[model samples]
Target: MANIFTSSIGKKLIMSISGLFLILFLLVHLLANSAYLFGPEAFDLIIVIMGSPVVVAMVPVLAAGFAVHIAYALILNRMNMKARGAQRYEITHKGEADSWASKNMLILGLIVLGFLVFHLSHFWAKMQLPEFTGGHAENVNDLMHLTFGNPYIFVCYIVWFVALWFHLTHGFWSALQTIGMNNTKWISRLKGLSYIYATIVCGGFIVIAVTAFLRANGYIG
Candidate 1:
């Protein structure tokens, strides 16, 4: 176990498992967030379920998965850089066959992480923390309305969703590849699967964000 943690293959395997876990969490989160499009009542009901003791207990597990994914990425990136040394700057791709998101995963991941912090501060902290601490807010919907009612937050959410889309595009397939699913037969299929999964997850969030913005702006009934 200790050797696995210290080996390159072990780290990749850990990252792959954590990535899959986070992806599953993203699916659940997207479903919860999409309830906002159904109106305030539906959204509040979803929030209540999310804040339930069972769901609340999984929050730390999800957070740990995210932390592990990011830490492994940073470590791998550093190792790659050191191995390349001065040649890193001189290397040029030959009209790369890989997707853009795959090549720039680290950059996109960082952007997604940055926006996640902003999101937690604006929404999660206000909604979940208060309840956990035995204090109370009037209602979750009130908090949602107040937060999304702001034009700046609405724009920030849009940007965050975009970054998330890019991150998921590469991550979905890469996770599978890392787990020994890279045979030629499955490679193309996995690429298509990645796009489909990324679209569903990112599209779900975009729908919620855009719809909330429109509703808050009086553009939607």
Candidate 2:
């Protein structure tokens, strides 16, 4: 069991499992945010549910998952760099087609992590933090409107999602491959699935952001 954390393959396995877990987390998050499309009442209900005892209880678990994923990622990157010795510009690729995203996953992940902190400050802090602290939580729909209403914020979010798309496109399939899904037959299929999944998830967020902006500006009701 100790080897699971110390061995190279075990570390990769842990990272892959945690990565997949976070992918599922993103799907659930997207679905929850989708309620915003139905207007204030529906979104408010989601906020209530999210702040409920059960969901609130899961917060630490979710945070731990993110911590494990990020920690292992940094650890693996450091290990690779140490193994590379003097090679500074060359990046080792797994037995898949060399793509820009595959090589830059760490960079993309940092960007996503940065924006994720920014995102939590705007939404989670305002909506959930107050509830936890015995203060009044803001109206979910109004807050969404206010956050997305800014044209600059809207654009920045779009860019963040683009970085996320690239990260997902590579990370998704690579994680699967690390977990024994790699085979001659499944390789191409997994890659295709990665692209489709990334598109739908990121595209959904883009749609929500755009619609929120339009509604906030009174261009749509």
Top candidate by lDDT: 2
Cα-based RMSD of candidate 2: 2.3
Worst 10 residues of 1 by lDDT: 88-97
- Residue 29 miss distance in model 1 (angstroms): 0.6
lDDT of 2 by residue, 1-221 (tens): 99999988899889999999999999999999999888888988888888889999999899999999999999988887777544432233244436788778889999999999999999888878887798877788888789899999999999999999999998899889888987768878898999999999999999999999999899999
Report the number of the highest-TM-score candidate: 2
**Model 1 — TM-score against the truth?**
0.89
Report each candidate's C-alpha RMSD, comma-separated, in the order given: 3.2, 2.3
Clashes of 2: 0
What is residue 156's positional error in candidate 2, in angstroms? 0.7
Displacement of the residue 118 alpha carbon in candidate 1, Å: 0.7
All candidates' TM-scores?
Answer: 0.89, 0.94
Give candidate 2 misplaced runs (Cα > 4 Å): 85-97
lDDT of each: 0.77, 0.87
